[model samples]
Every structure is written in C-alpha cells, then in structure tokens.
Target: MTDHGHNHKHASHKTLTKADAEKALNLVLDSVISAIKSHHNINITGFGSFEIHHRKAREGRNPKTGAKMKIDAYNQPTFRAGRKMKEACN
Candidate 1:
C-alpha cells in the first residue's frame, strides 16, 4: 500500500472555543432575526424555513403502567426544510 500523504491532516485543525462557538451561533441567530423582521419570513434558499409554530395540547399515554397523561400546548420555534435540503440528505 502507498501513503497518500494524509499525515498532516490531523495537525491542521484547531478546536473552536466556547466563546467562539457562541459568537458564531449568535451571528447566525442575528441574521435570521433580521430577515424575519424585514421580510416577515426567513428564506434559506435551498434550506427550509425558520418560523413560529403553534402546537395544540393533546392527550398522551405513559409508557410505564400504561397511564394517560395531559400534554399542554405551547408555541414553539421550528424548522421545516425545503425540498432541496431534504433531497440532499437522502
């Protein structure tokens, strides 16, 4: 077998710090928030939407002892990927 010169691949990467990651995440959130404010909708092009969604309360079953439980409805933030994004994963 021949070496493909992959020896340096491991040394070339740097780990992102917590602060750096938080900043990056915040940047993405800021952009989305700005888009929502201006356009009333977020358009990630090939990626689906980031929007507000309302969930209705319903009854649910507990696995242990087979008991019925009440589930409260709440508004939730959600993402629905577009066709292109969905197709790419598959």
Candidate 2:
C-alpha cells in the first residue's frame, strides 16, 4: 500500500461523527480493494486512480545474510493522483 504519511487522527477532524466517518471510509476502501483484486482500474476523477502493476520474477538480496534470492513475480496495486489532487496539495 502507498504510504502518504498521514494518520487516522489527522482525518478525524471531518464533520461526521467518528463512527460514521470510519464506516464511510471503510466502504470506499473496500470498493477500491475489490476493484484492484479483480484486476480492474478504478478512477475517481479529480481525486486519483488505482490500478495494478505487474513485476516480473527477478533476483533479490537478503539483507540479513547478504545472500542472493529469487523473487517471484507479482501484481502490485498502485495509485496516481489526479491533476486537481496534486494542485490541492501544493
């Protein structure tokens, strides 16, 4: 998952009550996760987009023992902010 460096407390200032806010947030998150799981791209205009990224199997290193290892290919979820979202942050 992408780490934007924000925490739950930071989002708790919304007008809705904590429970309602959490429920709404969870619903949205569940929908996004479901879409990604189905290999579908989700786009929320003016907010962002979510899609899957594929990585081929490759060699990797084990940091603890400095040993080489084979990393299996995988599909990773990725997000990209929309134009309006970027402008809002700046």
Q: Which candidate is the best by lDDT?
A: 2
CA lDDT scores, all candidates in order: 0.69, 0.83
- State the lDDT of candidate 2 residue by residue for 1-90, as single tens digits: 222222244346656665665666678899999999999999999999999999999999999999999999999999999999999999
Off by over 4 Å in 1: 1-25, 30-41
- TM-score, prediction 2: 0.75
Tell me which residue pairs clash in candidate 1.
none
Please report, as a residue range, the 10-residue window in candidate 1 with the lowest summed lDDT.
1-10
Model 2 misplacement above 4 A: 1-16
TM-score of each: 0.50, 0.75
Query: What is the Cα-based TM-score of model 1?
Result: 0.50
Q: lDDT of candidate 2? A: 0.83
Error of 2 at 90 (Å): 1.0
